[model samples]
Target: MRQRGREGLREQRPVATMEAAEGRLSSEDSGEMGGGMAAAAVEGIMERIQSDDEECRVQAAKEIRRLTKTSPKHRRQLEGTVVPLVSMLRSSNPEFTEAAMLALLNLAVKDERNKIKIVDAGAVEPLIGFLRSTNSNLQEHATAALLTLTASSINKPIVSAAGAIPLLVKILRDGNLQAKVDAVMALYNLSTLPEDINTILAAKPIPPLVNLLKICKKSSKIAEKCTALVELLLGHDEGRMALTSEEGGVLSVVEVLEEGSPLSREHAIGALLTMCESDHCRYREVILNEGVMPGLLELTVQGTPKSQSKARSLLQLLRKSSYSGSELQAETLENILTNIVAQIDGDDCVGKAKKMLADMVQVSMEQSLRHLQKRAFATPTKQSRTKRQ
Candidate 1:
């Protein structure tokens, strides 16, 4: 079997072996044209992938894995290999089946064309089937394959239609740490589309997902993906309720915004923005009371373009909440006070209005002075930086 894979690789070597010559290219090598495999090489691998002997097929699948990993061209050229891989996914031999699934997983690696081929070849159902297998390794590989397949914009619905959500949720609740990460990461990707949010939420993954967010180390990739998933989930009403109902729910998100990785912080802000925009008055008030303004203001100055936009929008919402739109809006505190003063008469009754307006102006001035002092402290020198909450 090993000899067979070697022979198969040897047939493809002229193009595949160019890496060997990369370091010592004489003038003749510079003139040599690039190369690729003949059809026979693919045929040999495909034949070995389906060989009656189990070891031979595993060897073939592994060679395919290596080729797919090393060469993007091999991944794209896998039109013939995907069909056999998809078929072998259902094989009764667990070891061979695992090998085949992993090979397909590798082939689908960041290669959208191969991903499409795997999906169209009917790999979803069998992969979802593996999720329920007593074999944890098989489950891990299957989750990984589903994760890769979902990266394509078109494959999310396909995987979801195959009833992957509930199975993935089960893995989230029961699988090893690595498997749990892959499962939530896939859920995060699926939730990228509004249409899939219902599918994910219907699976009831929120409890475990929120738990995942809370228990994982701060700013880790798992927590990052979990936060991103919750951010998307928060767009729906049910999602919002589930999240807030969880212990440390809103605060968990806020903590991530305060200290997670830059990407996690971005997602965390997105989640908070969704909450602040909710029609539920409690949502906005909770965020405001959480002392999010200072952190959001910091983001407006130092965050990425999108993060800055979101932070500014949230800050504007908070400001709008401070004085209801029904009460008034003005370019500045002076404008509002000027309007009030113009409307007031010298009557004793109007003294209350003038006094109220004067109080507003004084409070505004004090707050502005505080902001200036805070900014001065936060930005006095190149090394000075504000801490966010």
Candidate 2:
């Protein structure tokens, strides 16, 4: 009786297996059917976008924006729609232009190939034109599109050559808050190229950028980009001059050094170091007058490795700038050390501050010696291995 019961259960297993297989087949078929529908929808949207009628094109662009906003698959399928979307940007109608620009922007997001494709389709010129639009929304969208496009390295040179820098600077001065933010990011992206630095400076970006940084939170991402660009710009004499000319520019950078994120602090210190290194006589007093000593001292102890190194170098330069000749330099260094300690901890805690600084310097020297020893030992080991080989 038990054997018979087992046989009955075995017989029922095949029916269950058939039912599960059919369910899986039905699921796969539905997925394929859904994909086919999506593909068809994309095809219809593309055709309408390419139509000669303005209304049809506008509607299509709107659909493209809607579709690409949330669907990566739609973005890829709609790649061929770029040329038409770019063409729509030339429409006299602001609504038409914005719809198309936004659609292109959405398509470009996270799609490197589409970014290049949009630019290659001649999107930069119209985008720059929109940067000058009287319509705030249009101008903001245009700035955003440029910002998105410039994020691609390949688009940087092309966008720069299309004469976007001056317009971007203008936006920094006159655009709404969001537009200005996007403009700064776009300029930073372009500034990554070595050749574009002078162009950026020629537009006198320091004042506006300095003002922007002053208003923004010190640790915000925009502040990081602002300081980074400022650091790069200071490598040029004109840039340094412009910064000094801008009221509170140097002060703003010092503030970042004291209060910004790790990378921002690195840039802030680097900009100061560049100024001092370029011409200590001209810039040293300017920097020290801003109460930079406290931040420099703090950075030496607590900042990133790069920031720490830059702080030490700048501090050394500041010390040297105090007096000429070796003997006077030695005396000046001691006086400056006393001043730094006093500044940080007041007269009462000078002794304690000095002790702490001494301990930090000692630890730094010990680490340097260890690093040098490792390199020294590594050289001989490599040489002996070469000989053995």
Candidate 3:
């Protein structure tokens, strides 16, 4: 399979050699490609994955991926290849680890059998370890792989057991921008678990995340990630309780929303809307006390499409909260409603506030009906019943 020419070493294969082998390999009657030239080529490629030269290793890993993708039989036979590639995860060379990761990504693509195979090979732990690496690209790709694997509902428990939250939070604060983006996505997914979300709250991830939201408001990509994290946080009861903790709770996020990055403003708006759905009375007061309407109006008039949508959404949420419009500053409410009309004319934002207005109006009418229903259902005997109780 290898020719030792004057140049040192070269791949020399006779024409039709692989074709003949391909036919044999495809035939169920024939055994796997054992003790043959195909096996030798596979070995050569695997060996090159460990080459001292970085480029050679990367090239070899790419070839291995291509080879494995070509035939089901080839992939099954090369299942053992995961061992060497996974070992590269610990290599001092980031390039080697990256190439190995790319190869592993392809390896996991063959089928469910391969996916479980790689998972069983103990790849996740080491991959999570790379979250600590200072190399931005490695962190990004490794986190992406983990995100894919951990996407399954069964994997939620596994991810929590792996201590992914603290590591992810660390990346959020210290890693480069790409790393922060990846970390945010992982956290968003992991937040599906109540226990895992508690882990994030324990790490005090919200404050730094709020800080990041402020800094990254202009970046649409980062802003979207920030919004996702907020959505996840507010989705769970534990997460909401944590956010509304006395140290500031929901109020802290409101502070960030008002003072944060424009992108963060959008994300903050969405988070607040979700939280408002089930907020305690005090939490509802926090939103009104923060004076959200005027700031939201400003954002609607001057913010980006996402920001304008977020601001408008927050206005609708505030309107829906337990804080009755009568309790709110009437002038501020008017400004916000006007800004919504102005936004419709300006068209700076891509997302719309039309649905929000309808939702708020519906919620308002529903609340009013509930109040009237309660009063109408009351009987004169209720006063006597209450006194007895």
Candidate 4:
């Protein structure tokens, strides 16, 4: 039996030899392993982060932040390192907080496991509180981390339930530009579900959100996100009422349609369409009073089919509220046909179409005024008689 065992061991030698020849065998003779070196580096940084020396902690944090941003490899072995990093967030030391937050931000980004680990380490609450930080950098970094953590399916409600929503809205309202953008994006992600939308609306954020739209320049990234947020906010019952209640909402949306990105315009059209879908007479008059009907009309000719469809749907809703169907369609068709003829005759289609709609709106307004004046003169009150005299 011993002799057969020796023969079997000897037969395995060829396989080991083959593995070595293919460079598949772990070998000390191959020099220091990159994995070993990386592990050692991470362990050393972990020690520095926990060091009594504050400078060492900051340096370690900066190094860790750089490493995490460049790759996720070091994060795989982050178990021993996460606690000190999270603890540093509560430090009275602002540098420590910023460094730790940046390190954690980079560490948590694009790594769901790391995000879970950070949240498990009790990072979410402090992060939420930090959203109100007077330190813009810290606010920015904390928002970035929460944005990543909230993206985790497991962490979404954990974040919202922890009171992150209202603070996030505050950040969206008053934080620095980048902080506002980050906060708005975080809110956008959190507002993905119906429940999340209700939670956000309960925070009463529509006015500030509309303010954000006005504060950001036209065609800016922040404007795009604010427009998108309005689209979602319009999806909820409270959200729609909140939007309609906010005096700036309709005009802000219309401004986006005229000046924002293509996606912004598309979303603006959808949001207007949403407003018109609600049976409330005030909602229809709200957008119409913004004088956006001409822009809405232009969209029928120039918008994507989906947005054009939305524009047409909105026009149908608006016209139903104010005009008889046949009259409205005849006016719209006459304007479109005249613009089409001019377009074929080498005139700018947009220019001609806008002019045609302007003329059509003018005619409609004149006829409506004539009817109102006739009704008024028919009554002929005392004040009217004085004016007539």
TM-score to native of every candidate shown:
0.70, 0.75, 0.55, 0.74
Poorly placed runs, candidate 2 (over 4 Å): 1-37, 323-389
Best by lDDT: 2
Candidate 1 lowest-lDDT run of ten? 1-10
The digit string of per-residue lDDT tens for model 1 on 262-297 reads: 788899899988987886356765564333544554
**Cα deviation of 210, candidate 3, in Å:** 1.1
Q: Could you tell which candidate, 1 or 3, scores higher by lDDT?
A: 1
lDDT of 2 by residue, 1-389 (tens): 00111111111111122112111111111121223226677788878999989888988888778667645676788999999999888889998998898788778877888989999999988889988889998898888788888878888999999999999999998888767777877888888899999899899999888877766767766677789889999999999999988766787798789778898899999999999999988997678655566678778757898998999888777655333222111232235556766665578766764654443342223333344344334663231111110
The clash count for each model shown is: 0, 0, 4, 0
Winner on TM-score between 1 and 2 is 2
Strongest candidate by TM-score = 2
Assess candidate 4 and give its lDDT. 0.67
Tell me how far candidate 1 lies from the true structure as C-alpha RMSD in angstroms. 14.5
Ranking according to TM-score, highest score first: 2, 4, 1, 3
Clash pairs, candidate 1, are: none
lDDT, candidate 3, 166-236, per-residue tens? 98888887876655655666677677777777788777676556545544433244555566676677776
lDDT for 258 (candidate 2): 77
> Candidate 3's error at 376, in angstroms?
48
**Candidate 3 global lDDT:** 0.58
